[model samples]
Target: MTGMFPATSMPDRDWWEALWPDPSGLLLSLGVEPSMTALDLCCGDGYFTAPLAKIVSGRVYALDLDPEMIVAAKAEVKHLGVSVLKWIVADAGDVAELIPEKIDFALIANTFHGVPDQPALVKAVARTLKPRGLFALVNWHQLPREHTTVLGQPRGPRAEMRMSPEAVAAVVEAAGFRLLRVVDLPPYHYGAVFEHKG
Candidate 1:
């Protein structure tokens, strides 16, 4: 098991822009439009959110808990001239409180399992989206062995912080989201698109 992952302070613009999920191609595959407002939950540095803002010329609420990470994400958006993304400080419990309305899309990318109360989050984010809103749930596929990043960086979370797809799916379905697609293409990590049921 790995130790507590530190919030690496990214002083440079590139590092902040690089801190999100890589399976963005999957996001593209989901048919994201250029005029729909979206919410990016646990949006670390909002990397994907940046690209997403470009696609949706609409607003993106980039929500996260880490203050420095939130700051870095906003900086990146400003640097990239992305006027559509808004940074909101939030954890699992405070998301609904921050944005108490519906959005066209909701993205929980790469950071769902880190949440302490998974069920609460499922319900909270579900309430925040419009009926039939598209929600992309993405996480690392359970790899067979520990892996290293290309930069020789070890990547693994503490055992208590990880969650499996089936386990997560149960919570999401219970919150009224119907699984629309299960993407298992390449490079390992998995994602499920849940269409919020009205």
Candidate 2:
């Protein structure tokens, strides 16, 4: 993931959770079902992965490119003492190889802008998902200059690197996904939900 924000940029686990309060609520708003099998692509620090494990009846595959991030995520979820999660240290684009089972949902949050090959990544997600499976993406919205230049911004990619919702939808559609809906995630982000055409 060249030209991407490094894992070091991520805050401590608690701090990160505080920043994105109520991840479960957000997932539910995005149509994440409790019994669905999910793949948390680039699941850094288990911010979403841990909660996903709690909700999903099947399994949650938490995969990341950074080994340290995976280690931290595993530790973060260990308190729950649940075996619903399979933590894998791998690129987000290798979902087909890394996850053998057909996924009911795939969540890519906050890291889509940093992905080196957007089309390839989407294709991989499509390949791993079951027919009509959902792919939810939460990404930083590319706003105008005035909105993005806040001093001492705690997080988010560079302004130029951020992808607009339209841009994201094009990539998703090119990979054989049907764009379903777009929702405002509030506080500087938006979510796009798509379904694998199969």
Candidate 3:
């Protein structure tokens, strides 16, 4: 584990929603299917977790390093009256050991850039997923932070930390995954989907 992902990678909820008004729709566009078990890796406050649980018939595992974040995520899921398969508070690298079963899909949104050893984290995710499972990373396009504002405030990680789709694909592919496709997320982000080569 490269420790917790940098906090700057996460933004306030208001701007987060402003940037992604339809999280569930976004997830679907990223190829999340209702029948596949999913994992919300580095799940911040569960903004997407609640909707993810809704999509996968509550067969979603939400994990974050911060306990407070888990509490908030639990509240969010409760507010929606949906349940997650498990709400785990642990480092992202510990995902394989923490989840009871291999997942069919995994998502790490907005937090991939800050990972100190990106390839290591990608390998960890690969280990947690079932063979041929999909892993999707939603990352800020390599644009200046000031230009990617939301709710009238510049959001997301620093400009230098932002990654282009090709850069992300390189790292993930090196970790025993095949690049599937990159989906344009508009405005300031993109989703890169990879299939585990296991």
Off by over 4 Å in 1: 1-24, 158-161
Task: Single out the weakest 10-residue window by summed lDDT for candidate 1.
Answer: 1-10
Q: What residue pairs clash in candidate 2, if any at all? A: none
User: What ordering of candidates by lDDT runs from best to worst?
Assistant: 3, 2, 1
Poorest stretch of ten by lDDT in candidate 3 = 1-10
TM-score of 3: 0.96
Q: Report residue 125 deviation for candidate 1 (angstroms).
A: 0.5
Question: What are the per-residue Cα lDDT tens digits for candidate 1 across 94-193?
Answer: 6777885678888876667665567877888888888988888876666532551322344434444555778777889999999888776345456778
Instruction: Estimate, for each residue in 1-198, the C-alpha lDDT of model 3 and write its tens digit.
Output: 545666434557888778889999999988899999999999989989999999998999999988889999999999999999888988888788898888999999988888877888899899988999999999888888799888788777888888888889889999899988899887788999999989
TM-scores of the candidates are 0.81, 0.88, 0.96
Q: Which order, best to worst by TM-score?
A: 3, 2, 1
Candidate 3 regions with alpha-carbon error over 4 angstroms: 1-3, 7-9
Winner by TM-score: 3
In angstroms, give how far residue 25 of model 1 lies from its true place.
3.2
CA lDDT scores, all candidates in order: 0.67, 0.79, 0.88
Scanning candidate 2 in windows of ten residues, the lowest lDDT window is 1-10
Provide the lDDT at 180 for model 3: 89
Best by lDDT: 3
